[model samples]
Target chain A: MPKKNLNKLREKIPLLEDIGKDGRVWSDLCKQYGVENPDPPWRITLESTCEVLNEGACALPVLERRDEEDKLSEEIYKDVPYPERQLLALAHSMIKKGFFREEELGVQMEKVYKRLSAGT
Target chain B: MSKSDKHDHNAAPMVDEISDFEVLEVAVRELCIEKGLFTQEDHNEWTEYMHTLGPLPAGRLVAKAWLDPEYKQLCIDDPVKASLEVGIDWINSMPSKFGTPSDYCNPRILVDTPTLKHVVVCTLCSCYPRPILGQSPEWYRTPNYRRRMVRWPRQVLSEFGLQLPEDVEIRVADSNQKTRYVVMPIRPDGTEGWTEDQLTEIVTRDCLIGVALPRADRKADDKRPIHKAVHPYGH
Candidate 1:
């Protein structure tokens, strides 16, 4: 085996399944091929820091999520993704007010708001 | 355009306003009351159960490990086994017969060394060693923190105000599976012959979480931006 592949294999380790696969999770599945039990450097990373807004007005995707498109000024978000059904109301309001930017995306509000009620 | 027009008195938006979680919370509470699974009084008891938790017990656990080599081995050999030494029974000590619903029994005590430092995370979910260490921080529960920490550990650590030496191996512990971990940071100087209580005082929640170094003078985690909860669970 080449040195580079060995290094790559080592770096591509999996975490979670703690107690290391009933106590030991070796780096590569191959490494565990021989060793009775190996303790890979137990690395667990928790997820946070999600993007609140993207290029589009995409927001309100979940019930538990903090929503209220009215909190921010109009035109800040356009064609926001209805993370929840409540956002559909907000999305309609944004469209009725002509708040969506159609010139850039070449999408008219009447057409897109049609999808909002369809419940995608 | 006006406040009165927004209410939609004819077709009130209240129906859609209620979240799934909110609906579930109501339905579950009602069912429990109806079926007598647990009374309203029992719910309050559980709420009080949460009140008795903090970093005190976990801090003491780390202190004892620092003081005794035998105890330290117990921490390394069997964390749940060693939990007994600190008066925390991994099994048969929670509301559940087996263990707490959220934080299960599998516990790992990561012993930090002079050349190595340890931190923990649960990228998929905020699966923490809650029975022992209490709840996780809001920041630790973020998707960005989870996704970036393991891949770019040094970068994340720096964000947490931890700049480690290149030689010092930074071992990241993901508490994603059954097992949950707490860092047993290396005992620092200035406390030559300190008692367990004194040592525990310094090992605040931050040290166990691997965000702050345990120090004799410091007995608490530094305050940061705390995004207030709408209906935060409080005593």
Candidate 2:
């Protein structure tokens, strides 16, 4: 078989920042629908990023923290409403956007665990 | 009474007291609420909406379609509109008038034919048609099912006790986008003139997901080991 040239297919996709520079369309849609417009573009970006990345791979993301988070989400939130998983995903995304440190999450988890165990 | 004597034998023993995941859920929900991402009311309302959801409406949609050819065509052409016939207004049913944030308004009914079959999987995350079909099954959300269902659909279906002929094509609808899907399997035999309720009863959640076919005898999905929750949701 002859070698196929793949240079044309390797063009760089525009960065999310560049793509989100003009937010008029999205803001208009949000306004029309009575939904709050996502402030930091990261809200949509993180979700799309996960979708794009997952499209190519057969398995879930292998990052240790992500794996643990997903496992926990499945164990605890599987029977609950879908928003629980959504919130967990959003939290991770916020962490990615530097809203909070992973270490901070550990401390918060401990506090929350104590409160929950105490039946507060 | 001794310390051991106080323990009631009838009560279930506590397993892992407050797992890390439980802590993380609380931490994340609290942090998000504190950050003003969403209020506790919004979360509660969404949960309540979820409680109202189940596979019945989807099952009815399939049954109605099976009985009426025009409705079946309508289901193929405009599924969101078709959903209304079964009393599921995809847009206005939930707390969010626009639709559930995760499961957007766009829902497509993948109608199975004699020669073709359809199944759904969200390889990225479990993006199910929750507004209509309710919460996805625990197994469906697993990475193992997500991965294998897309790659080796035949093998996966066989494991679910669903084996089709070689000539019949198996299509795995990867719901990686905003558009969700519910499989409408071809109406099964042994019900030539059955009522809509009778037909709906046979179209179990598994049939809607295209895992198991609707049979006259089967009223529920195949029995699988259910992972008992440490603190199961009452609703």
Candidate 3:
């Protein structure tokens, strides 16, 4: 059973635009989490020199942020769920949490940057 | 060489015409139609539904979660409930009111951390989250990928251009049973002041499929080998 507020928001959000790439909050998510590594470097090799492969989009940024986040977590992660479930989990979380308020999503990012700068 | 070639040509070789499997598939389809188990229209409708699906809705789901904490919690707790926000009534959205025959309603959301990156592949069949994410990709339905990815995820992720540190955990969610899974990667840093629309653009099909993650500039999945069909079905 869902909570009343979450149920209400579910009725309002449109399907297509929900995941649009907004720049503000995402940077904060990165800093708040304190992720240090960005993605594995993309180096072309003999096996992949001419292969026209289609790994879905969003591969690069996700890889990039993953490193930074690892620095914050302090826990060993040998069993992360697969992509499908992970996407599903976040979507589920949104329904209950009501997204980062535009301001919070934006304002919080600065905190992340400041935290990193203090140490570096 | 000439004597051996002559002998090889004379031999009554194994059957080489239409494959037995192909014949059986045709037989079953025709028989189903003949028996009225379902009209040809029903199968065609299902195909049309398949053609209409993609990673769009699933991407939106992720973006919305990033913007709203409440919604994200809903997603993490009960994916079936969270899906309603995207207008996908898993139980009643498709031709089958009870959800697809293969992908059931039990969808579990997996959250990603800096030390954890996730990707999904079915080893037995192409079991996917059809209601929100649409149809599974062609490569995902192949036996070679399924057989290899679960047991050798790091090796496979490397092939997909994802190479994590040894300390990072690589959990592979196998949809071998009833529950289907999707990844919910934490938002990345490139965009500092993006709108909902801006965020959704980065969550591509491949990201939802677990091969990649969402970013600010990217609007598409990685380009891969495309094997054209002799007679491709267009919806």
Candidate 4:
């Protein structure tokens, strides 16, 4: 993408700031994709964030993604698409802004992923 | 001594054995304390804080807005700041300065105009704005409610004894995301000269959730069937 176009797209998604920030990403997503929040916007955002990263790659920031072994999950990192990982990282940054606690993110993300997959 | 007395004594232990949740709750609390993750005082203080919360503060916020146009606009423009006027600091009031883990911080007040109405539902889970409005009702947390409210809002509202005109726009605010919501219903016709206290009394939890409208005479939520517990906690 052109630098200007990328900047414009970034500017449009103000929810990039935190989990609880304004729903700029939400309204923009709604307008661009006709995706109405069939549930609370945050739940959908959390679910989507997990979905986009599921068994693909760690999209979180370098420091944030560090495991006890100082290595990425070999199973998750296998064959992860570059663009997909980039998107996941972007979503992680947004969540880290306020919605996430460093210690609980893994557990919360797993629960959210399970709940979304359950389709309830 | 008697046959019936023997049966009653046997039933008591069965009821005592019913709580798997209590076992998990004890395990978590003990583990957290043992690990020094949080002190007993911290848990007790949060319990105290939970006791302090109810729908009153949120109701008062709506009442204050109804009585003042500028405050009402502030409510729409900056809900977190406006929440302070009603004595709720979303971030600071609780033990966590960052706000509740699940509820987050931002609150969206869906302003009801003459033609439009709003209702809330969490299709995934029972995600409510508990900071100001206290815990959600039992029915609000039901999977049945979560499934039906989004698809058939009018029917659900009707079940709650709230029927609107066909011309009225009923917007369902699905609380699937982080941003919590409360519906600021349009001020009713008869409450013109009522004091803030009176106005506050009428804005029950249901009204804020947009299942019911505020009225001059009504001061409490509609009673519903509450599933009784074997050993319910004493308040």
Candidate 5:
């Protein structure tokens, strides 16, 4: 697909927006994070392209956060390709565990970030 | 009578247009009865069950939820448990004590908040919540709908006349697994003091499917072209 249409397709799938551009971008990111290559990259391709057209409405901010916290999860995801279900399951679990208070997870994350930065 | 003008009084008109599907249906039904797989009474009872189903139960569920915050929370938290409030015992409602073999028991009610909207489509097949929402529409079962709705929900929803703001998070739930989903849209503004029954009237099938929004004035889905069947199931 053309770059413009590919971007359009990417908008629909929020999960893939953090992985940079194209399949090669993902492979390159994996290498940077010392992660194994996801052969075929079907999960990223299918989930990113086959999602509803949410554009960058929900993705842009989340991708920025992912980039900021890249080191935190580098070891966990170093050996496997990113799957959409895992993300969804994690979010649902977090919600259930009170990791998110109402709509603003920012408040909870801020407290964690402060505690971590203070080395306590 | 003259050779050209003579009518054949003893001859009968012959036109056989039965499709392969119809022929197979008859054969399989007769074979089942003969083999005692299920009696004719079972088939008739199932058909009767189908007749009793429609979108009313689902609509009532939504309506009841709108009226009561606790009930609404139950709908969002545990949809299967909430289903019982609306008279749908997924386990014992049908002949199978364990629930309908195909639809299963779990129901996921997608609650649309101010900033989020939800729609559902079975990417692999038409796996609908039949016990609550009744039969899946012909359009929902079409391969065209299944393929496009997941990819181009905005465009398809526009065809259905639902255009949401860009800020709204449009979540498309792909019902590929055992869980089935229904969209419980936030109660519209016009129904300020509406009763549950009145509110239920506006929660049409399309609204439940996330294709259309509920309005006090609108009680039915938009009209579409429907091809007549050779032998229609219901009048």
Candidate 6:
């Protein structure tokens, strides 16, 4: 199947000017409903990506910094639900636990490619 | 060549090559199994669990709520608990005892009233209540839908053939975090004594997503063109 160019698709959609980098639109809506807004999804993705990459480079432990981060802002992330974030977090945890070396991923991926090509 | 044969020449290429994403997915799954994160049986069980999911359970939940007032309050107050009535245990239903790691446990049922309407969109990603509502529609996952639905909801809704009165308030619920949402539309008129089964038939997936409304005569969503997968699942 052909992959979609999401960046191109996003350009066609009309967005509101009030949708700030902090996700004010979501925050305002949550405020109207009397519920606390979770930190912007983009921010969560950004942080997760950074954490995962850092973990991959130098086997660091999972940062239990959610509590500190939550207290820093009124609109803070309460939970991580994004699939990419979940996948990255899992990889990060596994790396930290010494399950496998980050460098070995390329070799494993090649084996997987061979298996797929062989229709196994 | 014939016109048909000429048309086939312009069609998308059906390549047998595995993509990098496919290779990576297999590599990760295999590595996870090797590391004791999960077994092959667990992965197979999860696939089987996914096959059992559809819009029927979510529709039944709405139907039951519409038939019973207390149930409607339960739906609004504690949606995860209310999901139990439809046999969807968000936490323990999947392979993971806690919940599906990506979807998490929180589910909010947005109950619509005469003066208020609710529509859901995940501006960052498509965070759907898959346990009950099944796979999200392709349109829902599109960047166009994600960006436009949150900002120009009325315009987008109208494009989906749903138009509300000027006085009615439209709330666009952005499912950006753990809280997944399912819109429970108000029971339509002319179905005062309808059975739960009958009501459930009308509450289609589109209604649950708040793109359309249930009608006594309409038991299905408006027909739209489907993008056929090159390799459909379970083939």
Candidate whose lDDT is highest: 2
For residues B11-130, what per-residue lDDT tens digits would candidate 2 score against the true structure? 533232343434555665566556555556656656556657789999999999988999999999999899999999989876657753356899999999999999999877677898
- Range of the 10 consecutive residues with the lowest summed lDDT in candidate 3 chain A: A45-54
Report the backbone clash tally of model 4.
12
Model 6 lDDT per residue over B103-137, tens place:
67999999899999999998765678888898676
Q: For model 3, what is the error of residue A78's alpha carbon versus the real structure, in angstroms, after optimal superposition?
A: 36
Show model 5 residue runs off by greater than 4 Å.
A1-120, B1-28, B35-37, B225-235
**Per-residue lDDT of candidate 5, residues B158-198 (tens digit):** 87889999999999998877787989998999899999989
Candidate 1: Cα lDDT at B2: 36
Question: Which is the winner by DockQ between candidate 2 and candidate 4?
Answer: 2
**Interface RMSD per candidate:** 23.8, 17.5, 27.1, 20.9, 29.6, 16.4
User: Where does model 2 exceed 4 Å of error?
Assistant: A1-120, B1-24, B225-235
lDDT winner between candidates 1 and 3 = 1
Candidate 6: true interface contacts recovered: 0.17
- Of all native A–B interface contacts, model 2 reproduces a fraction of 0.17
> For candidate 5, what is the DockQ-based docking class?
incorrect
Per-prediction count of colliding residue pairs?
20, 0, 97, 12, 0, 0
Recovery fraction of native interface contacts for candidate 4? 0.00
| Residue range B134-183, candidate 4, lDDT tens digits | 86776675445766889889988888988999889999998867799989
lDDT of each: 0.54, 0.65, 0.53, 0.60, 0.58, 0.63
DockQ of 6: 0.10
- Candidate 5 positional error at A50, Å: 31
Q: What is the lDDT of candidate 3?
A: 0.53
Ten residues in sequence with the least summed lDDT for candidate 6 chain B: B226-235
Residue-level error in angstroms, candidate 2, position B192: 3.5
Residue A79 lDDT in candidate 2:
40
